[model samples]
Target chain A: MSIEIVNVSKRFGDFVALDSVSVSIPSGQLTALLGPSGGGKSTLLRIIAGLETADSGRIEIEGVDATKLSPQKRNVGFVFQHYAAFKHLSVARNVAFGLEIRKRPKDEIRERVHELLNLVHLSQFADRLPSQLSGGQRQRMALARALAVQPTVLLLDEPFGALDAKVRKELRDWLRRLHDEVHVTTVFVTHDQEEALEVADEIVVINEGRVEQIGSPDELYDSPANDFVMRFLGPVTELGDRLVRPHDLQLLTGGGEPDAVPGRITRITRVGFEIRVVVAVGEQLVTVTLTRNEFLSLGLQVGSEVQVRIAPEVGAVVGQPRLLGAV
Target chain B: MASHPSTRTRRGPVTYLVRLLVIAYLFLLVAWPVYLVGKNTFADGMDNINGILEDPDIVHAITLTVQVAIIAVIINTLFGVGISLLLVRYDFPGKRLLSALLDMPLSVSPIVVGLALVLVYGGRTGWFGPGLESMGFQVIFATPGIVLATVFVALPLVIREVVPVLEEVGEEQEQAARSLGANAWQTFRRITLPSIKWGVVYGVVLSLARSLGEFGAVKVVSGNVLGQTRTATLVVEEKYLNFDKGGAYATAFLLALVAVACIIIVSVIRPKEDR
Candidate 1:
């Protein structure tokens, strides 16, 4: 089901958690609400799920105004960040909670629980308590439980936040595949940009209780709506009169081109697949990334003379720099 | 990191001296008195026990005390769970004051609690006593009066036990259950109750112990009528004053044994609370 949020606002005493936030989530696509901490992304997600009430505005789920409806009536499933599994319940019972509450037939509930356990790849652990499982296993069980009742919308708040880095990467890919299989309209809040870029079909970037931009990963990376979006997506370097991304700058061994910005290399560091070169161009410092083959071709070292170039067609202009704090 | 048993450690002679002093103080104050009571009760062996057991008044007193304790524990468990839920889950005016008032039974002496109940529900001049008597029911100096006194003294145990557990568990699982289509009652029965079950058990144990051994308040309100309102402690007091030394010590020994059993049961069932 598609979700349409219009002019929603929320306040916690003196703090404004959401300010007229509006966004449309298309049906059957996984969307990520990405922002820094305290940016109100989680608040917006909770409001849409009906887990929290908005001070103003309406939420429509598939042409139905859901703002006045309770979370149960909205047919929305929510997975908490910490899993929140019942400690007294086994994995099978946890997954069967929603269906059991609906008073489904005993045989049907058992069958559905068995099916969900298999889908989450936890069939063997059906009889184990939540404490007996690892962090990733607990999260997967939480996902299966949320999906048991066949909700129209699935909302998750930092579902993989508590896991280690290696498990997080694994679960991200697993979640992407599971979403593809289920095809449920999903909205998840995340502070990690790489996770959002890799997993979401569309991203809604929020900052200070406002929508900064909404687009696909490539659209956000190539052409950001403002300096906030640009700096939020990745590192931005200031050249002479323009702001450009590190990947957009080119490094050269010889200063032949007239448009090239000449500088001396200060540091060369290999980070995964890309080699980063920090250069001192006059009084300004600029960073450029080159492929291993390109760096090998240049035969460059630290304190070597180099020239940087960003062709007119390749370099996208980001806004000028300002002091970084609340914004 | 390894050290021999004879090795000199960071802790000096003062630490050893302090530990020895604390152990001696507790043993002298607690263990010695308990030993004397046990020694006195069993001094004449089976003859002393048979003498107390043969007395019909002593048997009736023991039975009454057990019945009153059980009834008080049941009533308090229900109200205790309700009050704990209200205190931990919601915020409202006078919440702090309400919590403070729940502790009044603990701070006030049992005799004072009995007097307070009497002032509210005693003779025709008291607040509710006249209305209640006119309705063909009696409260003061009756079974109900004794029960009220015991309930008042045991009220705080269950509430104090359950509140901390409820606060620690939080509303996360309850919210999860709600979003999963469970209503308020279902959520409490399925999620909330099971989570706090251990705390309630611990509280009920304490309440049972307190209600069973209650003497001051029961004595003040019960009138100590023979075979009517006299509990085991009251019987023990009367027997001691009559110079029936064996009967008094035997009844007192029985109450102490029950209290010790309660402690053992509680320790056996206590969850390790991993944190």
Candidate 2:
């Protein structure tokens, strides 16, 4: 009912591709393998899909030895980084390919292909070849095809990577809904932190071919296991040679400029609902996101003496503060 | 802030130069031959080339070439795809060696390929010629020998094309096919073939072209039986030897035309990227 990967290590010649990677994905849950490129996330997904075999370790899906199984025998579904749909077949035919291979009654396969295509909201395009579909549609067709067999586990590798920004954002929500409806154990690989946060129930952050951290998205963002996870989870910039997020700082209104505060409002960014206030904390200017009403209320202009609050208790000291100012 | 998509990517001059050089070289070599063949095939009924156009002997040679090329291409396609699937998907002892050996045809000279076949089948005392004769079969200095040479020469082309396409093709569709209760044959027939169909077609057509134009290797094995074992290229050579310049040119022109036409069809029918 679940996938259990244990002590899996893959090596390509001398380089360690996956070092002792181990994790368990419970049935009916969506897990995200979040990492940078070459971080072994795709490697892990491929191993689970039986597209790759590890140098050492074990994989069990629903209490079966999946590591030893051929991809055809694993009963696991996979969606590649590209949709990888068969270009020659119509969408319905591609979806029914699995059923046809299984030698199901032809009528049954016809019924199932229609149902699956409808589920993916691609019923109208079912008769068209895969090449004619857009990127998002192709991905959905791939999903429908994978699901036609009613696989026990489903794996996707960067399913939205090839899409544009709008399509990628749209597919993220659609995919989550699809995963919820299917209620099958699934894992997807992604390098985008926002994608991992939005779609996955459990996010496993990987770095240098090893799992750096694994937890709920909020937990990992709030309390990262180490520096890498903290830096990776959100938009962070070097502040006084220390990592800091815009929301981490508190702005005080009318509190006399804190003694020794670095010189002032050098720039402003109009962000529709919010005006980003830029403060030159030294040679470096840091942008602080704020609402337009808040900026109007401040009524401050260029060279306005301002006091900015830094929660020292939260921001970790990274290096020499004075030296950063000189730069 | 959103950045310029074009400016976001920066390629070094070295990469640019390499790409341009390859494009130019391909246009020069592949494009030139293709243009010449196509131009002559449809050249405005010029009377000057009439002798070359009307030679019935050349028509016979063209027919012979097309027949052999079609048969040879079909055989190669079947065996090539079978072997490519085995190489990319399955694992067994000496798999690495077998994979490397697949390229032997491409690396070994065609002339030498003919010599190898001859040595194996008709060398003063071949390992199989006598056995084949006892079984009322023949492999050398006959039609079978011509076919053997053609197959050996065209073997690598299809496998090379199919393997990469198969490797890039996702395993999921085939896996999905199997889980749906498909047997091995069903998965191969439904999923594997569809996924790599375009690639296989392109490869087969290219192989056919090469088979039609193949000379030295097939010549050595065919024993040059006129109208029987004599292929188009051999026919062209015989016409040229007889000082029938017009007939030789016509045969050569027709063979070239078929090769060019096949390539054009392949390009036109090739699947577009991410279609």
Candidate 3:
């Protein structure tokens, strides 16, 4: 199901959790509400799930007004950051809860629970309590429980936030695969930009209770609407008056371009296949990234003077005057 | 390892002294007095206990006390769980005031609670007593009055136990259930109630103990009629005041036994829940 949120606003006392935010989530796509902590991404996801009410505006699910609908009536599956597993219930029972609530046939509930558990690769732990499972397994169980009801939309609030980094990456790939298989309208809230960039089909960048930008990962990284979107999506450094990616800043031993700025190499560090060179460009320290082959050929070291220039292609896209959006 | 040994030796004397003091304090304040009560109850080889059990009036008082206690516990459990959920899950005006007032029963004297109930429910001169009596329900000087007093005194026990657990467990699971298409009642039954089960059990056990042992409030509200309004605690007082020492001791022993049993049950249940 597609979800359309129109001019939604919310406040907690004097704190505005969401301004007049509007966004359209397409059907059968994995979309991410991405932002920093307390930036209202989770609140917007909750409002879409009917777990929270918007102060002023409308939510339409599949073109049906769902602003005042209860979460139960909205048929949106939600997964919480903490797993929110029913501690006393076994994994299978947790998965079967929604079906049981709807008074589904016992055999049907069992079959569906079995199917969901297998889908989430948790069939082996179906009878185990959630506490016995690892963080990743518990989150998978929560996902299975959410999907068992065949909800119109699957909404997740930082579903893998509590997991360790390795487990988070595994779940990220698993969620992407699951989305491909299930093809349900899925919206996940996350502050981790990498998670959003790596998994989501479309990304909605939210900040300070408003939508900053919305596009695919490539679109956002290549042509950010503003500085916030650029800085948030990936590592970007200010060169001259423009924000550019570290990898886009090229170093040359001899200056050729008029736009090239001279700087002295302050430090060089090797990470995996890339080398990071920090340059003291006037009062600012700017970092330039180089491939291993490129650094080995240059034989650059600390105290070496070099000229820094933005890559031509990247410069053509991001070298425009910075546009400052609403705070 | 060398530093640890030196620290341990230095702190050993003070630790032992504190342990000794606490043990001595508990033995004198609680263990010794309770042992004496048990000894006196069994002094005549269960004769006192057997005699009290055989007496119709005493038996009636004990039965009445059990009934009133069970009813009060039921009322308190329902009210306590409901109020705890409201306090933890919802926001409204006066929520803090309501939370503060829920603890009033714990801090206020039981006698004051009984008097307050009487002032509102006493048939002769109470605010609503006359009208209630006219409608064929007698609250004061009757079984209902005793129940009201017991319920009042034990009101906070369940809420006190359940509130922290409710807060700790949080509303996330409940919201998850709702998002899974569970209605309010289903969410409570399947999600909220199970997560808070241990808390509610602890609360119910405590409320039961408090209701069973209530004295001052019951004494104030109950008219102390020979067999009608008298409760077990009242029987203990009446027997002692009337020079029937053995009967009083026996009744007190039974009440003490229940309270101790409650404590034992809680301790046994606690470790399993913590796991």
Interface RMSD, every prediction, one decimal place: 0.8, 3.3, 0.8
**Residue B116 miss distance in model 2 (angstroms):** 5.0
- Give the per-residue lDDT digits (tens) of candidate 1, residues B1-275: 35576455658888899899999999999888877877888898877788878889889999999999999999999999999999999888999999999999999999998888888998667799999999988888788888999999999999999999999998889989989999889999999999999889889989998999999999988888999899999988998999988888888888888877887887787778622
DockQ of each: 0.75, 0.30, 0.85
Candidate 3 achieves a global lDDT of: 0.90
**Cα miss at B275, model 2 (Å)?**
13
Error of 3 at B11 (Å): 7.3
Q: What ordering of candidates by TM-score runs from best to worst?
A: 3, 1, 2
* Tens digits of lDDT, candidate 1, A1-327: 399999999998999989998899999999999999999999998898788899999899988999998887888889989999999999999999999999999999999999999999999999999999999999999999999999889999999999999999999999999999999999999999999999999999999999999999989988888888888888888777567888888888876886686789999999999999999988878889888998899999999999787755763567542321112
lDDT of 2 by residue, A1-327 (tens): 498889999998788889998887878899999999998999998888777789999999999988888777888788876777776689998888777766789989989988888899999998998879999999999899888888898889999999999999999999999988989888999999999999999998988889898898888887677768878888655556656666565455566644225558888778778777788776767766667777788786777767665555664323445554344
Ranking 1 against 2 by lDDT, winner = 1
User: What's the CA error at residue B63 for candidate 2, in Å?
Assistant: 12
Docking class of 2: acceptable
What are the TM-scores, per candidate, against the unseen true structure? 0.91, 0.71, 0.94
Off by over 4 Å in 2: A237-244, A253-270, A275-327, B1-74, B82-118, B123-146, B153-187, B195-275
In terms of TM-score, the best-performing candidate is 3
* DockQ-based CAPRI category assigned to the predicted complex of candidate 3: high
